[model samples]
Target: MNSITHYLHNELPRINAFLEAQTARLDPVVRPAAEHVLGAGGKRLRPLLALVAARALGCTADPYPMACSLELLHSATLLHDDILDAAVMRRGRAATHVEFGRTGTILAGDVLLALANRLVADYDIPRLNAVLSEAILRTVTGEVMEIANVRNTAMSEERYYEIITGKTAYLFQGACECGAILAGCGAATERAAHDYGLNLGIAFQLVDDALDYVSPSEITGKPSGGDLREGKMTLPLILYLRTLPPDARQKLETRIAQDDLDAEAARAIADRVAASGCAEATRDAARGYATLAAQALEAFPASPERDLMADMLDLVLSRNK
Candidate 1:
């Protein structure tokens, strides 16, 4: 685990440098907004998966530029999502939309999307282009579905899975699949890469949802229970609701419908979720996905990159933020 951590610590900066260069290409007026968001660092999990996948397949390609492009797309999504969620903080800093006005932030996001497309266009691989485009399309569809379902406390577990899988998991799947494709791996190996990333991504998001209830704002990069405050029904809350008796469930639903979603209300709801044992339930589901993610590596030979991915699965399941 320490070795894998060291490798990631060394490699992430290269990706960061690549991102810095890519964002530099934007107009000076738009550059600050893009740079601000880019500079606010994240786990960079999607791009890391790409690099690891390429390495696991023994590909000689640099993989950095392609990996960086995926990060650009992800940052763009975060910019848009903050606006949609009316969020103020991101990565412990003001959200791009909060720092830059809505119009400017929107343009910044568009610039990122355009730059991402431009980067892949330079690769001139039709299949790579298709994978990126499909990922974006699926992510957008999932966002729209989530927006349409806002405040729907009755949102089913099945629907929640569909939303998170499409919005989050598919992008990770595309990144790993594209990485394997760049490595010129066999079809079976490419399928394994996709599966590994897909399951990892699901586990990642599940942990993120769990963190929202248990982690502090300093760690989570946003306020605790922000999902519930935004009326987004995540798995913990959904499962917690199921545990309630009919009248208790109705009262909780009524409480959720109350206006303002003040701090007191958020904490109250979070307390209920904690006492109901739903956080543990959500973690168990995340463990299931992590197991699937680990299994996906069975087809690949033993390598530092593969071992790094195995360690990452543990990190995802155990992460508090």
Candidate 2:
């Protein structure tokens, strides 16, 4: 295996352990449900980013608590998001709400969110908790925006970016910022970390949106054309719109605005978006952000940790699932 993959293998188990161990202090009733979501498989991307950020900045203190906070925050979002989206599967398993019931899953997610904040609070760095809290607030706001804009015909590219930056990028930005803060890095370096994470997070979401149109169910652990059926206008569909003639664009917009689109109709439109090369266009946009993310790392001097973090950009851009 390549170095990045090898490194990921080395770190994944350690972070997974940290994620599980954090739940031990929770009330027993909520503990099992919390553990269930935590145990459900994931790449643990947010936590790993924090750990790597701390290492890159030459941190001496243990970073696991801070690192794990990102995962807890992210997991909590997943639990709540699955419910909001009415999703049936996550990480190739039944969604937490499906197995645990919606109320239990929601409570479990809320507990985990609190636990995440508590972990940061224990650090005694008021800024760390502030950073995490802002991320949570922004993330939730993004979700609300996304929900509000469903089937919205006038959704502009600028507006989409605004929503996604909150929906995905802020948490990523917060993760790196917390990592840098924990390392006691200078303000300039901390800014660099923030830029890198913000751009990378945008790229990550763009790719996910692109994949929604093309990836098979097994690959994404979700239904094909799920976004289209749900009336969510993603980057691929948005880009595809710009290429159509006036009448066709109007028709497509009307279709997107439909209160209910069946599977066949959703699949058909998704296929057209894929075949028109808009998915690739979305990926190309992702590459631009990925490049920016790489440049952000240049603010720091060379080190194995820095190089590993840079490699993560390539990994994010290359994700097909």
Clashes of each: 0, 0
Candidate 2 residue lDDT tens string, 202-319: 9999999999998988988888999988878788988888889999999888877875578888888889999999999999999999999999999977899899888889888898
Please report, as a residue range, the 10-residue window in candidate 2 with the lowest summed lDDT.
252-261
Give the TM-scores of the predictions, in the order they appear: 0.97, 0.97
RMSD of each: 1.2, 1.3
Global CA lDDT of candidate 2, please? 0.89
Model 2: how far is 293 from its true place, Å?
1.1
Highest-lDDT candidate: 2
Candidate 1, clashing residue pairs?
none
The lDDT per prediction is: 0.87, 0.89
Residue 141 CA displacement from its true place in model 2, Å = 1.1
